[model samples]
Target chain A: AQSVTQLDSHVSVSEGTPVLLRCNYSSSYSPSLFWYVQHPNKGLQLLLKYTSAATLVKGINGFEAEFKKSETSFHLTKPSAHMSDAAEYFCVVRTNTLTSGTYKYIFGTGTRLKVLA
Target chain B: EPEVTQTPSHQVTQMGQEVILRCVPISNHLYFYWYRQILGQKVEFLVSFYNNEISEKSEIFDDQFSVERPDGSNFTLKIRSTKLEDSAMYFCASSGGRGRPDNEQFFGPGTRLTVL
Candidate 1:
């Protein structure tokens, strides 16, 4: 069984400050990690993904996450927080070897980001 | 920018009534999925479909739920009996890869199901 844990249920950051949302994952094998953002009452949109090729992955809207094997973590970060960055962030894990292509994607509970101006 | 599209932005149904949520995935995507989120709750995986058949399903996807790709473009999820617990925002997503990083699943705006 694979699972993901988000360190923060909510994170508050002032504009122009660094933002971090922590996530840890447990998987039997090397995993595919992803960061998704959902605006209020909206569908989730991909922020970035780590597929083993790059440990430091950059995503849309200036968001990025670093995959640390030793820490078993993939934490989302942005150098400067913007009002648009305020949304619910989800850390997702998926097994690369799962027979069922769709069975492996597991979502973390979520971390709501609040960007204060 | 191709995107997954879903119908019935909102649906209201009585308990025991049947309901269907529809989606049209990106034209080139091969895998499709269904997930739901109760108010203020995490999104739960319901089922995954590929190659015209169900490839994976979660415990929540019991006999009451079924998925069908009636045509080349449309994927549909049907709930046999509506329950108050089933009320939530149901999302449809699609991807183009078999596994790993290339398989980015794009999601639809979702249909808000309200069961009375």
Candidate 2:
């Protein structure tokens, strides 16, 4: 079975400060990792994805995440936080069932980010 | 930019009633999916549709749930009997090209289903 765990339920940071949201995963094989953000009453937007091509993946809104296989972690980071960056973040792991040949996405509990002005 | 669209932003229904959630995937996308999130819970995948059939489904997607592509642009999820536990935010998503690991999935705003 595959699963993802988000270390923090909530994180608060001051504007212009660096932000970090930790995520770890457990999978039997190599997996694809992704970071998604959701604003209040908005859809989940893709921030970045790791497909084994690059250890460090850059995404929209100046967000990026590094996939560290040794640590079993794919943590999201932003150099500076903006007021609009406040939202719920989710870590997702994609895996496939051998028999079905179908993809399954496992999501983490999520981390709510608060940007203080 | 093209994106997925779901109908009925919110739906409230009595227990045991039937509810249909509709989605219009991106015109050029070939793979469509349905996901749900209970209040304060992680988002869970329900099912995936491609080539006019269900390519995959999670354990949560039981016999009570069914999906259909009645038209070229519309994908629908029907719950045979709604339960109180079924209340959640349902999201529709789609991806272009084959349903591969690298294809990015774009999500819709989501439909809030409330079963009273």
Candidate 1 has which clashing residue pairs, if any? none
lDDT of 2 by residue, A17-105 (tens): 99999999998888889999999998899999998898999999999999999999999999999999999999999875645445667
Tens digit per residue, CA lDDT, model 1, A1-117: 778999899999999999999999998888889999999878999999998898999999999999999999999999999999999999998755556655447899999999999
- Model 1 gets an lDDT of 0.90
Inter-residue clash pairs, candidate 2: none
lDDT of each: 0.90, 0.91
Per-residue CA lDDT of candidate 1, range B68-113, in tens?
9998999999999999999999999988754432477899999999
The single-chain TM-score for chain B of candidate 2 is 0.96
**Candidate 2 docking band:** medium
